[model samples]
Target: MIPITTVKYPVNEFFQTIQGEGLYTGTPALFLRLQGCPVGCPWCDTKHTWEKSDNARVSAEAMLAKTAPSEAWAEMSAVEILNVIEAQGFTAKHIVITGGEPAMYDLMPLGQELEQHGYQLQIETSGTFPLHVTENTWVTVSPKLDMPGGYLVRPDCMQRADEVKYPVAMEKHIDALDLLLKNCPPRQDTIIALQPISQRPRATELAMQVCIERNWRLSVQMHKYLNIE
Candidate 1:
């Protein structure tokens, strides 16, 4: 077993940016991207965060130093993080908790801390681990398929998801989505989105067609296509 003591988060980068997916899409938010993922998605754009040890580990203060003050960041305790958000003069109330698979960490403290301060917490996860989070937090579980360092996305993860944002490149990915959905209890409010893999137009066409036929939603990586970080 990898010793928990040796497991320090790489934290490749963090910044304030408009959230680019799911229900909170287009909302200006603070992003805390903890680095390290075991569930490998073949097309993961942020694969740079895959290793916990290789990337430089720095204090949250050092991480914040790389960005602009107006960009809204500071090395923060749960309480201190809230203060920084208030100080930033941001009117947006969303807080996005993303990562190289944030489910790898016990995020209860961080989630509870954010909620106490009135911030709506949204977690973008690969659903490889059983999630431990506050009841009110919104979960976007983007399920992973067979890849190196193979991990099974637990059934509980899908059942708990507020949204299932599946990435698609071809029929195999759609098959994976169908398999996952087979286990999830059908509900009207359960959001099903097909995000084109890597903004490919052919893939987008497939996703759009499926969305139109099933009354599901399409999740375009608008941030990438729009050339925003």
Candidate 2:
């Protein structure tokens, strides 16, 4: 096996922030945003992360100092990452691995390093890439349907998801989710959460109504509303 210190991934941004959505909402967490994604959801908030450029790679300090989202990233091994986290003095014990599709890179090394030091790890994924994190990692699979990228949500992802946080903008979105559920069923105990697209009033209303009717959870992005991170 390759040493965990030798297995590196592109690190876009690493900071301390409150969990903005899904099941871990409001929880203080360390956010690790990886760089690079091919799943082109037109509504992607972090479009800057969609492409990885060799020229854009910078030092860890440069990546962490970014006040705005950009394509700039650092190539970091699991060991180097832990050192930065500790040096930053972040109080959060929960770490959220997010991105331009975090599952695009194997996370076992990262997961092992974090969990060994008593940190809880979570991943917010689009359900397009096969997961390679530790079994103990909390997996939130946000199913992206019929996006421009044309990537299909894997059935194995649905099965592995601890929560299915689907984004909905209209009744048709809910209809699509229903079809997906029928075709690629999640575990019986998986939490089903609906997040409104861009928090539009109509979208929020539709999400709320559907959540009420289906007994699913509604995930309002509190961080966005509270002006945090």
In lDDT terms, which candidate is top? 2
Instruction: Supply the global lDDT for candidate 1.
Output: 0.74
Q: Give one digit per residue, the lDDT tens place, for model 2 in 8-53.
A: 9899999998998988998999999999999999888899999999
Q: What's the CA error at residue 113 for candidate 2, in Å?
A: 1.0
Residue-wise C-alpha lDDT for candidate 1, range 1-229, written one tens digit per residue: 4432333333445567888887677888778776778777777777766766633555666766765322222233565565556666666667777778888877677777678767888889988887878899889988886878788777788888899898898988898789877865434577999999888889999999999999989999878877777
Backbone Cα, N, C clashes tallied per candidate: 0, 0
lDDT for position 71 in model 2: 99
Q: What CA root-mean-square deviation does each model show from the true structure?
A: 4.9, 0.8
lDDT of 2 at 157: 97
Each model's lDDT:
0.74, 0.93
Q: Where is the poorest 10-residue window by lDDT in model 1?
A: 68-77
TM-scores vs. true structure, each candidate: 0.85, 0.98
